[model samples]
Target chain A: MCLAVPGKIISIDATDPLMRTGKVNFGGIVKEINLAYVPEAEVGNYVIVHVGFAISIVDEDEANRVFEYLREMDELAELEDETSS
Target chain B: MARQITIEPVTRAEGHGKVTIFLDDDGYVRDAQFHVTQIRGFEKFCEGRPFYEMPSLMARICGICPVSHLVASAKACDQLMAVQIPETAEYLRRVMNLAQLIQSHALSFFHLASPDFLLGLDSDPATRNIFGLMQSHPNIARDGIMLRKFGQQIIELLGGKRIHPGWIVPGGVSEPLSVDKRDTILAMLPEAMAAIQRTLDWFKRTFDQYPEEIRTFANFPSLFMGLTNDKGELVHYEGRLRFVDATGKIVADQIEAEDYQKYIGEAVEPYSFLKFPYYKPMGYPEGIYRVGPLARLNLINFVGTPLADAEWAEFRELGRGAVLSSFHYHCARLIEILNGIERIEHILNKSDILDKNVRAYADPNRLEGVGISEAPRGTLIHHYRINEDGIITYANLIIATGHNNLAMNRGVLQVAKHFVKGDQLQEGMLNRVEAVIRAYDPCLSCSTHAVGQMPLHVELVNRDGRVVDELTR
Candidate 1:
């Protein structure tokens, strides 16, 4: 199964009430994702996306925890590269 | 009430699907449906985003074949910018795409399809899985694991990480391939090749055992479609779309990727979220065509590699014109894995593969752009229309799984009629029905991950062990 990471919704398209869409930033890479399932989702809210649909809106605390883990991964990669060099 | 049989989350494939078999009053099969219960609109969400992020964004479509989406989506973005990617980048992308095909096909063959072949379809449901294959055929299991690992490792080497590698970008790859990485991938090819060759040989021998399945499981005439090289040789990463009729005559020729919507028309069904795409001229059900490995092999002149070409010849011998049996799709998939590795090996040995110039920087130059490539499953196209600011206004993705929707439905019905008996359903009967769908390897997540869970409908099995009615919870 593909892992659905929680990315922050930076923008939302409300042109259609029933089918909502949003721009989500997974760190730097921004993707416009469907927010139809998560009608409550707004700009700055974090949601976990699978395929193109936002399955669930992640809480700020849980989203932060995942982000912290990601940062640690980046740091670990840097450490490994430095050691290898 | 007629006996209704439902198999949920059709095992071994990437995503979820359910097979519903409705039995007639006399215990004959009435109708069977391959329902895509999940749908995440990849196209709906991609609107209003910059074209450059498409490759990475679309890669999320399927973890099983992310590189397929990455390459195809990148090509669309490249078209959006109206600039040709550097030659080295194209070569590098081709290598990555092949690696993806190898890895994804390995999962299909080794992880998903092999259990049915190695372990008999009649085997215990709990025991008829990869784990069962391990307990029974340890050496083959290890080889399968190692083969998939080699492909994944190569992907990691080039794209930086195995799953959802963001290295593939709009203009080109994010970085150049390191010589060390190339050498490492080359060294592993031989072992991978040997493993697949062994598996292929074993599968060919096993083919004779399942005469019933070969003859009945989606074994019928349907138009075949795929990408082909300039001279009409089998090409995966890029080429013109070609469609061959059941009699192996060219029905459609040299159709450009951008003009796909003109010829390919999508039809919606109430049962499955996956669209049934058919050739426009034929219209609706009559226009139904199959795509992916079997279709690719059926539509092509040759596989364009040594090891796979040998297998392709044998595969073509399965039928007169186009191999109608979807069981042969399993055969075509394994051959493709072999070809993928060989092609990647050939690419690594080339000189310009190491060229530092990979990306071509450009702003959006066109309002509309379409990109097409062969995913591990079949032909994939990503069409995008951008606004003046380069933000995507509209997008349409025709996935390989959806392309096989018509054939998959047909396979389900055929297998249900052939296998399912009475109200007393055996586990193997359901497995066989699911296997028919697996033959096409439908990735429901990639196809239509639309809605999460549907309302629970309780199915009541009677004293006679038959599902007579469904009660809504």
Candidate 2:
């Protein structure tokens, strides 16, 4: 019954720590989400939101590192093929 | 002319469902089909969403078993990240999942299916409900409420909310368990144990009252599938997949979640929205296997808990091989509740349960991932494929109810053939038909991923498709 959506933070109202709120973009839809749980979340960061609250901030660097490693492995495979040939 | 009797919006279960029983001209039952009328494309719409959001997003599927969706979805996400979560996080997740099982099973056995057991399946329709159960068996009613609350309170204390707790993240839970929360859950265990034990005793004493029901309510041979620990003991959170034949012989063991597609196959029927999952070796219709409480109890060697192990020993004696009757699903649920309470207490006592290292940080390390766990009803599976950007490209979920689709249809026909007579629609007969569906506690909402009410409506029509008689409650 409870629905959670992921969105990018557009603005943050951190004036009140208890009532920290942020405008988030869920695809084309936008809504204000409670950011009290994720105090370190900043504008432009993606957050996993549930019942109007942002429960976790998406790890962008850690997310990108996975693909970076994949790219490096692909490059290494290409070099290995050339050397073997 | 041949006639079709349709039960629209099957009552006392989650979501919207209907049953169509075809009768020959002389009023003999010919066939029956259980149709899940509503559909929500959770898999289709999930495309392009980041993989990390999946656990919470999928939790929207059903209120009753949101934690199941959360655990399965999170496990899939964990595969994408390719990181082993902290030991404490695993224990914490296990606790929440068991709590979810206890509450959901209580809802099925006590709240939804108890009316028939308590008031007699032939009782007055007007008062045949949870309220009716409350009025007639107040202590049983109170126990149900209190037991359900005990489980939900644990979920709330852990996840921050009872229904859709977002605390269970991809790598691990977002927050670690506090000493306070741990002690609170421990305090609730004794009462929860007593309540489940009382209910179990009552159920055993009353079990023999319905010999006819025990024989006809989907009582037949079928393959059973569930997750089990390395020792082949009962498990709910994480374990290898095992499949056993009706005779309780292991057909497949130590099957990993990633290899599910190789062993299990999904087939679709136009009659129902829910997809039928079966063992690939046996193929469709022939590969029919049951999951959930009955299967779990049948496949496990022991429950590994003092109280539940005792009950499990007695339960296994119910059948030479596997308990064939779906009627015992109610009994299996009570035993599970007892085990869940014991298991939760055991985990809470772990030294590392309060450790702060609950979650691990990682990037997507794999393109495809699969998560499998035992939900309240049965085995739940969530599969996802994400692009390099970690956006989901494909998603598929085999809900517990969907696994029993073929068997549920067979069960409806079994009950209909036994009880339905003449052109008249007897309340007791129809209730029996609905009761068979309840035996499995089919969560139609989770199966179809649709939202709706629980009240029932039935329509009897001739082969010409015109309604001749109708019943609603």
Candidate 3:
């Protein structure tokens, strides 16, 4: 079983030059998220997304760590190659 | 206690839900659970509010279908207020409902369901979504986007802002449908209709390709529920509840919207926050029934609109008496798109559609009220009890998805039992489960808005209670 939840942001737009927004991939669906709420956020960040709105920001390391843990347990079915045969 | 899996904060719809597929000792499917993850205390919240305030307050329920809630809540309030709204108001309300129908059906089909259909079930997960759809079918995606925009534009012209427009009040709308706006909306109708027609033609001609998808995808038998006028016409607003069996025979007729409690009963489960509503007469589990587009199409013989009628005939020919497959819900919605165009055309021709006599002010002297209307998904009912001081004492909201709870669960289990096999998880099998939810288009934010997000943790344990692995995303 795999899950999707909200995480906080350690930094905003850590990788992107776009300061107003950055990229966050939820289960591999990367969407450019707005940094209106947490202007202080930088690279390696997380946030709860709903209908294109970022309800809250999450931690990047925590989110990656969760994915790693899920990957170890085989609960997180890597969607990276879901389309690829 | 058993093998478990969880997808927290499921997306592509209004709110949130999780699907849990249970496996038996022999690796056979046990039961599949689709749990609605959110719960709002709206009913309890309305307990102490005034009757007239319902239309506006209930409008806040779901940003997607607030009009449905507003219409239902206002109708119920009208019943208590005992004031007859003008005929012109009724016509305007119908126009609003049709506008909502056009946009909402467009969103569900083009934005949500079409990705699954056009992308191919087994396609790459990353590319199988809306982004991929944009790349592949740019025109088709554009049609959906434009069509939905038109619908929202209609609502904005008639109500106010796109979502949760506060135009429809108890007696009538807060204002009249302007002639200039009507004319402008009418101007775009032809292009919109053409776009919809193009997509419809494509789907109809290529129907054969989706045989496997149409046949076994949520194609289980269940009862149909919807609203019908006294003349037994397709009634979206102010009508009685009608239930029909799989054989297309009326199981119950003339069931008043106010007395829905007499026939519907809600069942609770330990795993999910959303309640499973069942047919009170048949009881839980066995009383499972379907609502929404699939159910609505099953209940109606024809949509009456010319283009829609043509598509409806094809839909019936494809699925027969009732299309049980959730995949066909997308098809049904397209048909409604045609129907909405025809309905809009008829309304536009009527002079009363833009009459200034829209609002009918009524004294809020009643202690209790009920509002009921056929939401695009299914029947939506809002019941409120207010004290003499004009404060609410009790409230009950029967949303479109809530009405189809039993049927949704049944569809999920049916798909799980049929497609899910062994320990191996297949994308096709998972899509089937998601397809079932798509059929109802359940709005979790509308259903429940108060609860904080809960973490979904699923574990598959062996006989010795050893956790071989844990998956958390």
Residue B160 shift from truth in candidate 1, angstroms: 1.0
Candidate 1 residues B302-363, lDDT tens each? 88899889889988889999999999888898898888888988888898898899999999
Name the top DockQ candidate.
Answer: 1
Ranked by DockQ, the better of candidates 2 and 3 is: 3
- Candidate 3 on B14-92: residue-level lDDT in tens? 2455566667787666666666655334355456557777776555434456677778888888877778998888877
DockQ of candidate model 2:
0.03
lDDT by residue (tens digit), candidate 1, A7-79: 7899998885434677887655576675644667789987765444564565686566545544544465456
Off by over 4 Å in 3: A1-85, B1-14, B445-473
Please give the TM-score that candidate 1 achieves against the real structure: 0.79
Q: Would you list the C-alpha lDDT of every candidate in the order shown?
A: 0.75, 0.78, 0.66
Q: Write the per-residue lDDT of candidate 2 for residues B1-473, one digit (tens) a residue.
A: 12233333321222455677777777777777887754444466578789998886566434447789999999999999998988999999999999889877876777668888888888765566655676678788778767877876888899884346889999999999999999999999999999999999989998789999899999989999999988999999889999999999999999999999999999988876578888999999899999999999999988999999999999998898999999999999999999999999999999889999999999999999999999989999999999999999999988888888888888888888888776666777778877888788776432111111133455555566655655554
Cand. 3: chain B TM-score: 0.90
- Candidate 2 residue B181 Cα shift, in angstroms, is 0.9
- Candidate 2: residue A66 lDDT (0-100): 27
DockQ of candidate 3?
0.04
Best by lDDT: 2
